[model samples]
Target: PRLREELKKNYWIVDNGYNSFPTQIPGEGGEMLCDDEIGDNIIGVLFAAQDTTATVMTWVVKYLHDEPKLLECVKV
Candidate 1:
């Protein structure tokens, strides 16, 4: 409810004859996305991003610990 209200307040639809764009909704080919689809996609992206960040951070820490010179270079 709050998300919908915020989106409605901040976003406006633009219709330029050939295409219609809903600024707050995620869509392609001029199709409007439903709230459930948008929510699912957002959740999926958040999980993927969180997983990737954790993996990258783990690798960075491992490399930094293995190579003191590389860590020093990064700090500088």
Candidate 2:
């Protein structure tokens, strides 16, 4: 896939956990991740992020329902 190729061509820079350190980190098995693994990880991260955002928003709305002044301030 194009994403895999781009990650490979860019030295697997996206999720290898070495962006600032400038080193190559291995996957769970001490090897570079295959294309499928990268895609799966991407999906996992997306789902996790969305779930977190939804939880935060739910809590915010719940609290807002209890505080009319804060909710009105937020609308402005």
Candidate 3:
């Protein structure tokens, strides 16, 4: 119930096909969503993207740091 309420407060489901733009811009063609939905989508995506990027970056950095030879080989 709580989750549903929160979803209702944060998301406004738009009708399908309401967001066709002249150019093919992913997600930008979506219908005009309510402020809450927009905010939720922004926050949710940012968090998810940031978390994944950070995790991958951390692993990559660690790998490079621990394997300088490998890094050098790649740089060549």
Cα-based lDDT for every prediction: 0.55, 0.55, 0.48
User: Stretches of candidate 2 above 4 Å error?
Assistant: 1-48
Instruction: List candidate 3 stretches off by more than 4 Å.
Output: 1-48
What residue pairs are clashing in model 1? none
- Candidate 2 per-residue C-alpha lDDT over 1-76 given as tens digits, one digit per residue, 9 for 90 to 100: 5545544655654345342211233565556777467546545545777754454455457767999997898799
- TM-score of every model versus the real structure: 0.37, 0.36, 0.33
Reference-based lDDT, residue 70, model 2? 76
Best-first order by lDDT: 1, 2, 3
Q: What lDDT is reached at residue 35 by model 2?
A: 49
**Which sequence of candidate numbers ranks them by TM-score, best first?**
1, 2, 3
| Residue 65, candidate 3: C-alpha displacement in angstroms | 0.7
Q: After superposition, how far is residue 73 of candidate 2 from its true place, in Å?
A: 0.5
Q: Tens-digit lDDT track for model 3 on 1-76? A: 5544534443432223232111111233344456456445445545777654454455456667999996897599
Instruction: Please report the TM-score between candidate 2 and the true structure.
Output: 0.36
Q: After superposition, how far is residue 43 of candidate 3 from its true place, in Å?
A: 23
Model 3 superposed RMSD (Cα): 15.2
The alpha-carbon deviation from the true structure for residue 30 of candidate 2, after best TM-score superposition, in angstroms, is: 39
Off by over 4 Å in 1: 1-48
lDDT of 1: 0.55
